[model samples]
Target: MSFSAFRILAEALTGHGGWKPMWREPEPQARYDIVIIGGGGHGLATAYYLAKEHGLTNIAVVEKGWLGSGNIGRNTTIIRSNYMLPGNEPFYELSMRLWEGLEQDFNYNAMVSQRGVLNLCHSDAQRDAYVRRGNAMIMAGADAELLDTDGVRAMYPFLDFANARFPVKGGLLQRRGGTARHDAVAWGYARGADMRGVDILQNCEVTGFLIEDGQCNGVETTRGTIRAGKVASCAAGSSSRVLEKAGLRLPIESHVLQAFVSEGLKPVIDGVITFGAGHFYISQSDKGGLVFGGDIDGYNSYAQRGNLPVIEDVCEGGMALMPAIGRARLLRAWGGVMDMSMDGSPIIDRTPVNNLFINAGWCYGGFKATPASGWCYAHLLATGKPHPVAAQMRLDRFERGLAIDEKGAGPQPNLH
Candidate 1:
């Protein structure tokens, strides 16, 4: 049922018992026109857009676990289009635009908060670099503003601006960029897709692919054999393992990226902030907890747990940026397996196997790129062509010598 103010009032008047589950838990069907692997944000969004935008509803989004139980639920919830590269900027801008109208379009309260995102610059060189990045953001139709030390101080007065080692020189601010409720995004997509006649199959793991004569027509799952006209894998961290079953080795390495939240405090950080000297970023949740994260683990692994060194490194960065943060007690932390591509960019393209598509290698940008990723993937699956904004996110970009290395961190997954 659609949620509305009248419904709430009626439910409240009637003892508040009219609420129902967001989406149904349907059993897997034998066949579908399109089968999407993984029930995370991208998969559910692909199914939703395929039905809403492309008018194709015979889709199945199969998941190994409960819905939103992946990177979609394990993130700092930041969203922005502050990219510098042409290959990445436009696509993220599209995602940012989509995020602006997502809750209204899907009729759900995903909490798309545009509280702004500030990227601090610790040195003159970093400030100059942020100036260039801000220009690029403006060029891509995204909002950006270069903020001096005083401007940044006006926003976040508690920052360690006097640190001699890494003094805060300036920052790049995206007035329209901010955070969202990550799990609610997944739920809204799932509910929208299900309402439009797309099947969401949870707890049904894809064991293998139904490939014959170099074409994939279905998948072999833990439940049973399911046939499909086309199969798309949006498996995130499990991309390599899932495609390995089809004998396709990806250039993606799996690394665990950890995130943390602190004990509740009075409102402090009104917007997202990133430390320039290090890879730490943080924002305060509506519930008063300070949510933050840092770089991925240095090693390659599929386990959704992080090492201590990375945690220490992240905490150090946080303390370095805001000395007062050291006083807050750490409440808890969690990790998500990141599919880091060689050049630290995502890949969304048709694989070598006919009728089989792949959407993986999102690295650290997956959560922010959810809407555009799904929109582009659905466009590709429906039209057999890449969306204009996502044309550079091909699986063979590295082979074609066209890697979109956003960080200029070379081809190392650990560095990006």
Candidate 2:
């Protein structure tokens, strides 16, 4: 559908004001077939898939805050499956496919724009890495094309193209990847799941896990206690804290990722662009705002605030790429906490704690992987087995020395 048609339909279903609360607190039931923590995109998508795909409707998505108040709402909303690692490739591919069908499935206009995403390379090593990633995408049946300097200039004329510090060389173009409406995704899944008899509990904080006989049976929350036969934690930043309450420690660190947006201007950028050398990316939102972001702060912090250096670095990168944006005034900036895993991939494995499962450690890519993460997470929770696509994200990989180090670097947060 055209972008205008998509926006019209979405606004009609969700109201012109965007995602507003549609349901209120339902009394905490004694037990649920499944209880998912965090009502962000991943959790809501999991609940929606469990009800729609698996015919499991007795689910409850418990959130500490309002829906989409987490990283789902905080991310830049870029969607792509341009992964180089084996473990991450198929899973993200599934997410990209799901993104293509989200509007139809949820009957909500997600405004998913497949305007494509370009990952620019500045060095020979980076170019080689892009080639490898492009090959992997092709092998996985996803659309990825390598572009040279002239090709890059032809596509994105606004870019400086010739900067002494960070010279533009080529890029890895994933034609199937792009951006989506972040808030609409949350509400689409929430409304779709709520319509299917799933209970969405907001403002309910999970304080502790109700472990019985070394097995998770329920969760103790701020509102009260609620039992569940199975529990999946999709809490991104708070994954470590939630798992710690269950006496589990993951090799995940909480870091802050900041995003910035310039004041609305006439549309200039038609697609998402990333600088591999400088760790920056920018995409124009449908609202005519330039949404952009960069690497996380090098330190660990639960505080969802970032330093000024990153903002400066990101804008510098943007100026190096698209000099025109240098004239654009940055209107707003915000930060979100991310669970940067030791491995740059996610962990979607069944825990040793019986019915407890996890779908965390997405780093900064969780928003894009929401749909596929939910699909795989629901499969794992329903069958008590890992799906083939997400099999490599097993929890034992860390102990087994089979880490899927995508960036070819050891398990380190800064490298990602």
- TM-score versus the correct structure, for each prediction: 0.99, 0.94
Q: What lDDT score is found at residue 15 in candidate 1? A: 96
Overall lDDT per candidate, in order of appearance: 0.94, 0.89
* Winning model by lDDT: 1
lDDT of 1 at 121: 94
Clashing pairs in model 1? none
What would the per-residue lDDT of candidate 1 be over residues 153-243, giving only the tens digit for each residue? 9999999999989999989999999999999999999999999999999999999999999999999999899999999999999999999
Clashes of 2: 0
Give the clashing residue pairs of candidate 2, or none: none
Off by over 4 Å in 2: 1-21
